[model samples]
Target: MISINNLTFEIGARALYDEANWHIKPGDKAGLIGANGAGKSTLLKLIVGDYAPTSGSISMAKDLKIGYLNQDLLSYHSDKSILHVAMEAFERQNQLHTEIEKLLLKLETDYSDDILNKLSDKQMEFEALDGYSIEFRAHEILAGLGFSEEEQKRPLATFSGGWRMRVMLARILLQTPDILLLDEPTNHLDLPSIKWLETYLQAFEGAIVIVSHDRYFLDRIINKTVESRKGKLTIYAGNYTFYLEEKSLREEIQSNQFKNQQAKIKQEERLIERFRSKASKAKMVQSRIKALDRMEKVDEVDDDNPEVNFSFKFSKPSGRHVVTMENISKSYPNLEILKNTDALIEKGDKIALIGANGKGKSTLLRIVADADNDYEGTSTKGHNVSQTFFAQHQLEALHLENSILQELVAFAPKHTETELRSILGCFLFTGDDVFKKIKVLSGGEKSRVALAKALTADANFLVLDEPTNHLDMASVNILIQALQQYEGTFIVVSHDRYFLENVANKIWYIEDKKIKEYPGTYQEYEAWSAKRVVKAEEPAVKKVKEEPKKVKAAPTEDNKRLLQKKNKELAALEEKIAQQEILVKDLEVELAKEEIYSDAVKLQDHTRRYNSEKASFDKLQADWENLAEEIMELEG
Candidate 1:
């Protein structure tokens, strides 16, 4: 738990947070949200004591344990494997294990009482810590963070930067600190990995404060939203969706108050003007003027709504077939990235390509965009397709010396400088910002410039690879809305589930050496994918008819043996049949239920149960007939 009292942090002339009082209680799953420069990450750093506040103090519990994972991880170059790096979370336990092993060797060499006593004490201490489960727990966290079993054994130095970040995440997740601070935690995670993280954090018994631009991830993982804006913080009691709705309502109230204040100020001004012309009413006018001077206006939150109205106008629609891919296969040495992948982009079709990290979704996108021609693929563009692609490494690979305006002009049409500057302003760059060199731009600022360039490509087909990276939720939503309304073919590879759900009319799932399409939204694709995974994991066995086991009648004088045995077995069978009947009835009722019909599993279960019950009924009837025949034979 941490508390901030009267905190004010200023960067240059601008105040990031001013007089902000906040407390994060134990087990609080809070989300830090704001615009790019609104200082969400800076506030997180303050709590973690990486950066001290300009004024006021941050207080924490005595001996508080905190773990913070920033996007910028100091490179960890060592001989340690990824598993060993993650296992460092239990370094003490690991050391204890080593000591225990040493003690075992000593016990064989020397039978002295002192050595035996020391070994016994060490063993007891190690057992108290539950040291044996440390390796298993570390592996679980690593797997959840998307590290394969094989990759865990590989040297950490072999991993790329993104995978290194995941290794860091895995370590943090395994640490289980009292206070967990995460900055854009889900940025490098795939859908499966993100889902795993949600499950991990949901059950995590610690305080969590996360800063993420992924709306769907925030909505699923966070219970509270702590929004930072213009030197203030406002806490919303709910998920991101609830925050959006509640914030809108709060803004409407503030706007109404602003309007009423303006009206009152205008009325006071008119009254003062009217009386100022008369000598008799001069004292009353001066008194009212003094009152007006002393009155402080109600603070209305600054609305950035106008800055968000970005409109992208393309030159014109292109031919029917915007792009095409056939038998695409890409490989990097031993890594067979993508194999026999094929896709088509018809004009005005919005498609989303999705998969786990290292699954070659981006590779497929690059092949389609012709950015990587060293692949076996026939990627064809239709007449007037004029393709433009945004890659994941675009920001880092840009000409840093070029100013923001220069970058735009470099990509935009030769004579469209004026129009390009206007477009840049819509994305929150103007005046001096446009003149600022790219070398000085932050990760987010560079992303905005890249987006502006992508928008002005004058192309009907868009191949975007993680374009939403470094963008805030508002900007991502605005882009999604624009794409939804755009009259062009779009193919994007992204981990942001919410964005995909909104904009994707078709989904391409790259999995298990093949590319598959789902004719629906991301939610539908998720359901089908989950079911497919479940099916894959399920035991492959044909369930055959199981003969019922029989128990002999107990011989007791207090009861009729034959009758009691028959009754007991009958009752047991009846209960089972009743349960099955209940299930059948529920299925029938649900068949009439529209909601249940939409779920594939429920429908499948219903049909399977219906057939199973019919077979059970036949078997039960035959058993009854056989039992009756035996009874009559015994009676005769």
Candidate 2:
């Protein structure tokens, strides 16, 4: 849908993209990956027209629409509710609906052939665009991005910055443009939300170009990979895994080629130096010089510099049971998040806490860490268990006035300056970076500083909440390695499946106000969950088929009682289905109204209720039919 030809973009003196060429065809799901400063976001901005290329051009197909979601939150229309803002994505659909309504009113007031013809045309146009389902689809997109039924009604200003970004994402997804450009789309999402987005993108009928640090998300949603390095773009034909392997092989081959050419050049230069004064070898010397001059020099492959290497060291080991929670019940006002949940964290256990947003994953983590004592639970720390909790907003606790070096030193006052500097270096802060004030650092940089300070806190147990939110791939890899080597118990709440799969040995899933412990890696848990879902669904189908057999056997008192009960159920089911169908119809009518669609919260609630009622109505109608057949056979 979009094409970049010889695109050269620069920021001041530094050239980010030099003569880079890339093509995004229709339905292409491409992942844009690079190191932290490799201009992945900048490339996205270039495509979205936020940045103009210094040279060359980017061209798009005629009349193509584009949806761009940047890392920052979009603050326009902040007074509107989340649902209302998201519904705005369907501007064309809304406009068509308005025109259709106007035409209907005109036809009703003054009947004429022209009015009738215009009304018919508008109705056809509306149906062609599926305008009737606009509000429903908008709600689905918002809910998938982690907005609750109640929260969808609240104004955008009420939500945190992270959640506001999710609203922006929902808007972009609902737009359904010809092409999508997303930068770090999953940075603010929980595990369930990420999974929902993954499913949504998998079925999206548009070309997608995403710049993200999430390896697993990329693997699941993208079919192609575009990598940026040293002002050039390289395309890989497969997913993130394929890109990694292919890039490695290409780099190795290039390194060898460069080495061979260097060897040949040295040999030629040596021969030229020796034969310069020899008159007998003049022709050979000239030939070799010409060959050397004509040969194109192969550029040496540049390896990634500033590789972060560090390991966590516990000051002391905790007891076998590092932390324990029993009979835990947490509630806020009318809502009960967790109830009677029990968990045990043994020494050296790496646990990943996962759940949908607002399902209390972070709450449970905080309760165990003693960060929040306002809960009905018995949580205890084992002997000699020194705990450090890294909240999602822990970076805010850092002194913004202090430099990176000052922050680390404050965490470990006794450590020498050189020791602290070495630790900061391991976190990718080195030389001038260490002296940079924390206030000017970006969110990712602040996260790095906070993590570096936490590693020096000498704690044997850690409770981390979304620790990898702002980390790049390399930084996340480093943290995974360090945490793997740490001889301590830790519970982490993270959405990065790749990071969790590498670090977690146990998965604690929270859903329906209960915590289920799965003693396996994340991949294994996924497999188990899939099987469980299938097994749970099998018995429902079997029961429906088997129940009718008993009613057809004989006409005893027990059988008669059963038959009467079935008849009563059938009548009730018919009434219920009728009522639900009416509700569904009413909801559809309400959704078609401009006033209702403009109110986001109402749209979401009505949409959900409509879907729920429609599903129940269908199931009840099927059961009623089956029971009616059974009654007829029994009476005969």
Candidate 3:
């Protein structure tokens, strides 16, 4: 647990936090969020004692253990194996083992009482530490992070940056510290590995604080939200989606209050002015003047909202078909990344291209975009179907000294200066902002400028790679709205589930060296994938042929069939017990409502019924486990 009180952190003239009070209770799973440079990370560091606040204090639990994983600290040495690095988490246990070995050597040389006593104490300590399980835990974590048995033993130096990140994640998970501080933890994780992490966190006994841009990850993992903005922290009691709705509503209320106060002040001023202008009402005028002087001014609430507006429009195409890809195959030396992949893009199709990293998602996009025309594919555009590829690396395209407006003008359509300025205004780059040199702009600003140029191209087909990376939620939503209203084909690669759910009409999942398409939204794809994963984890059943029944079928047959039915019923009862735990919690909360309190007798009855059901369920679960053991032994 950590507590922050009246904290105000600042650097130079800028205030990151002002008189902020924040806390993370024990076992709390919280998502920290804000626009870029909002001090979310700074607050985390303050809690960890890495940075001192400008004023106030941070209090943490005594002897508390913490594990932190920042995005850039994922470097791994080439010589160390993945398993070797993960095993280092249990260095204490390893040291104990070494001591035990030394004690064994000492015991062999002498049978002295001191040697025997030391060896006995060493053995006890080793067993208490669960030293034997250290290797098992390392393997489990490495595999969970997607490292195969052979790959785990491979030198870490041979792996790329993404794999190195995975190794770092494995090490952190294996450490199992009391509190986890993860910043963009899912950046290097594939879908399956992310799911594995979700399960691990659900069962973890400690606390978690995550900073992520992935909305679905926040929704599934976090129970609370901490947002930093305008030199303050705002706490919300739910997931990312819930926080968004509540924050918007709160902002609207603040805006309304400010408007009402301004109107009341104007009315009071008018009354005071009229009274002062009348010579016959001199006393009243003096009284009004005193009242105005004594009146406490209602200060307008500051706008903490960070919404960036963006608009994009494209020219209507001459035809319906946007792009067509046939037999796309890409390979590097001995590795065939893509094999005979084909896809067709029709007008107005909002497609999401997704996959595990390195599974040819980007390669497939490049093939479609015709960046690598040497691929074994024929990609064609329909008549008047102009296409544009907005790479994630578009910031590298801008040269030094070109103003933002000038850069766009070079690629923008021939139009009046007023028309170009109006287009720039839609994206929040107006007046003075338009004159800033492109080389001086921030990552997000450059992204918006790149987007403006793409729109100005009037391309009917847009292929975007990670378009939502630098944009904040407001800008992302604006882009989504524009895309929804646009009459063009769109293909985008993104990790933001909420954005994909809102914009994608279909999903193309690249997995296991192939591309597969799912009809419907991201939620549908998740649901479908969940069923597959659950089924795979389930025990496989092998059907046996039924014995032919005679008029007086063997008496043993009836007994065997009845026993099987009983076993199935027992299993169902055990499952019911697991379900009831969740159901009882819900009912307990529901029965405490005011409406239920109005009927005390009914509430008492329901409570008693729930208690009875729970007792029976628990007893059934115990019996089921015993019966399963007996059945397994008998069958063997």
Candidate 4:
């Protein structure tokens, strides 16, 4: 557990955090969110003591351990296997094991009692630390992060920067720190890896503070939200979605109060101005002035979400079919990506291709875009269809010397400078920002520039791969809006579910070396997949549950057949119970007759018959209740 109090941090003249306060309790899963450069990542660094706070203090439990995963860890290099790197989290255990090995060697040479005793003590400590199973634990965490067994055994220096980031993440997880501070933890993870991490974090006993733009990941993992805005930290009781709703409502109230306060001050000032010369109202004016001065000013809500006012248009509309693939098959050495897969893309179809890594999602996108032709397939475009491929490689395609505006101008020759700048504005590069050179921009800025260029192209069919990567929440929202308004067909491959759900009307996935389509939103696809998995495993689970019932004897047996029989008997007994009640009522009516009351014999006979019927009805009701209970239990 850690606590941040009155944290005021500054870089030269700029205050990154001003009087910010946030408390991370044990078992808390918190999402730290904000716009770009709002200091979410900086706050994480402050927590881990990478930078000293300008003022205030951070308090933590003395024995509390913190594991931080950040982009800077990408520079870490090592020749040791990834497994060894991950298992390094057990530092004490590793040292103990080394000592034990040395003692064993010394005993082999000297056969001394001191060496044997030292080895025994070291072995006891190692066993207590569970050093023997550390490798297994490290392997499990690495695999969950999408590392294969062989890859885990390979040297860490052989992996790319993104894969190295995953290794750092794995090491942090293996450490089992008391609190985890993760900055964009899902950035390097694919969809399946993201899901696996979600499950792992859900079960993690330690607290977590995640700074990420992945809304879906935040919603699935975090129970609380801490929004960094205007150099202050504000806490919400629930996840990202809840924070949005609660913030909207709070802003509405604040805006109203601010308006009302302004009106009151205006009225007071007018009275003061008109009554300055009048002696009678002087005291009232002064009182009103003091009240206005004492009142706390309410701040107006900032407009965080900006609409993408620009529209995407192409010169020619595509035919009914935008793209078609027949008998498509792609493979690599020792890996089969796609096998005779057939898929078609119709005009106006916004398909989201999703799945785990190594499933050929990007490969399939390349094939559709005609960027890769080595595969055996027939890929074609419809008449009048113009294609544009937007990928991470697009970042590489941008000229570093060119400004954002110049880049757009080169891509879209027909659009005027004013028109191109308008599109750039929607991507958050406004005014002078459009003139900034591509070389000066950050990774996220470059991505936005690439996306702006992609939109500038007059293409009727768009193939976007990981379009939301390196984008902030606001940038992702802008892209979603742009895609929503675009009339052309597009297929986007992204791991962000919120982005996919908002933009796509169809879902595509690869399974069993074939392409599959689900004609619904990402939310619908998730629900269907969940039920499908349950149904797939239900047969085996149901068989295990039914085996005992099938072999039981008649008394204990409550199989389907016996359950049905009980249900039938309960139904029949209810009818008899109903008739018995009517019979008892009829007997009561006869006993109440005037003639029967006057004659002793008739009255006695009628009373006795009524009593007999009532007793019979009571017994019948009791039997029905007992049978119903038995049936209920048997069914339960």
Which residues of candidate 2, in runs, are more than 4 Å off?
Answer: 103-109, 112-114, 148-153, 269-295, 305-309, 414-419, 430-432, 539-636
Every candidate's CA RMSD: 9.5, 8.6, 6.8, 16.0
lDDT of 2 by residue, 507-599 (tens): 998877878899999999989998998678442434555755443445788768878988788778767866777787787687655344434
Q: What are the clashing pairs of model 3?
A: 78-157
Full-model lDDT, candidate 1: 0.79
Q: Write the per-residue lDDT of candidate 4 for residues 299-406, one digit (tens) a residue.
A: 777778887787777998999998889999999999999999899999889999999877999999999999999999799988999988999977988899998888
In order of lDDT, best first, we have 4, 2, 1, 3
Model 4, residue pairs in steric clash: none
Local error of candidate 3 at residue 463 (angstroms): 1.5
Candidate 1 residue spans exceeding 4 A from truth: 305-316, 414-418, 533-636
- Regions of candidate 4 where Cα sits further than 4 Å from its true position: 273-294, 539-636
Q: What is the lDDT of residue 222 in candidate 3?
A: 75
Cα misplacement distance, residue 633 of candidate 3 (Å): 18
Q: Distance (Å) between predicted and true CA of 635, model 3?
A: 16
Q: What's the number of clashes in each of the models?
A: 0, 0, 1, 0
Which 10-residue window of candidate 4 scores lowest in summed lDDT? Answer: 537-546
TM for every model, in the order presented, reads 0.83, 0.83, 0.80, 0.82
Best candidate according to lDDT: 4
Ranking by TM-score: 1, 2, 4, 3
- Which model, 1 or 3, shows the larger lDDT? 1
